[model samples]
Target: MRDLKDIELFLLDMDGTFYLGNKLLPGSIEFVDTLRKQGKNFMFLTNNSSNDSESYAEKLRKMGLDGKIEVFTSGDATGIFLKERYGTLRIFLVGTKKLAKTFEKYGHKIVQEDPEIVVLGYDTEINYEKLAKACIYLRKNLLYVATHPDINCPSLEGPLPDAGSYIALIEKSTGRLPDYIVGKPNPLMLEMVMKKTGVSREKIAMVGDRLYTDIEFARRSGILSILVLTGETTLEDLRNSSIKPDIVVENIGELAKLLQKESGE
Candidate 1:
């Protein structure tokens, strides 16, 4: 197991691991503050592409957790992938207005028709027209990419349909799957983080609530994984599953103590 003291970067999940809706998780702010004080680096990583990083940051600020911390979304990762591989192709995006705006900001043109590529995100504002168009595009067998493979996004009300759910809908309709699913458990996002931070896999850790996306991200990326029970996952779920978290804690509060102990503070 990778030692906590050696961890230099903490790639964190937003909704369940760090905070739930507007309320910050217990010790979340203290965890980030500890990282800052200990000279460690951390970034908020979310599979939800409904909003841009700025929006999440703004939400954090409003929740009294203001800082210079950077946020990265799967949408950002997918945008980077598109810009690097298919920069010239006009793309049809099924997502929220915020996600569309970020795609355009990343230099990808969002077209209404005759698109060469189709990217699916967690479209909270999805309508019948958007789903119908996506089905049509998938039926045409265009190059398809999705931001993340999360089937459901956590919400205060209940789990919401996310990109993976839409992917299933398209698959059932057209028998076509995404050419690429660029998000957690794929290791691409973590690679981008490594590139940006110059941190090795051994020195980086992923903290999240989901086993498949979060723990598997660490497994696939050769990094340490910490699973917190403050989310959708339960102890029984952890035991019944094959994917294993390197460390387990009740919440970020406990994680803060473990980190402090590892550093001999």
Candidate 2:
């Protein structure tokens, strides 16, 4: 196992890794403080696309964390990736109006009538009308893309259905799955992070609570993975899972201590 001291950049998952609902996990603040003191960098990376990056930044700021507009989200990554591949293509966004605005901000053409691509995100306000339209669009052979495939999002209230669940519904109805699922655990997200941060894969570490999404992304992308027990995967889950993280801790608190000890700080 590689040492935490070797990590130069930290990629943090939001919902389960740093905070859930309105509460920050133990040591989340200290983790960031220590990284900043050591001149290391971290970025908040989330698969949820129902909200825009600005919204997340504001949330983090309210939670007493230093956040900026550049914090990455599955929605942002998907929009940027799509724009690069198919510039200004007519896109039918199956997401919140906020997410649609993001695509529009990038100069992509948004059309409900005849779209070239149908991008799905975590639409909390999803309704029958939206689903019906998405079904018809996909049936007509428009390219399908998903922000992420997280089946559930962890909230203080409880786990709620995320974009992946909606994607499943649409796929069942249209007999077609998304052409691409862009977000955590996907190389596209890591690629975008590396590009934005100017960090190499070896210098990056993905920290989260899930093995399937967070750790899988690190494993597949040749980056380090740190699993904290503050969220979804339990120790038993790790034992049974095929994918393994390089380091496992009870929570971010212990992780910060590990870094302090390693650096002799």
Q: Each candidate: what lDDT?
A: 0.90, 0.87
lDDT of 2 at 220: 88
List the candidate 1 regions with Cα displacement exceeding 4 Å: none
For model 1, residues 193-248, the per-residue Cα lDDT tens digits are 77667888889999999999999999999899999999989999999999999999
- Which pairs of residues clash in candidate 1, taking residues 3 or more apart in a chain or in different chains? none
Query: What digit string (tens of lDDT, one per residue) describes model 2 on residues 114-172?
Result: 78888899998888998999888888888899999999988878889988789778878
Top-lDDT structure, candidate number: 1
Off by over 4 Å in 2: 67-70
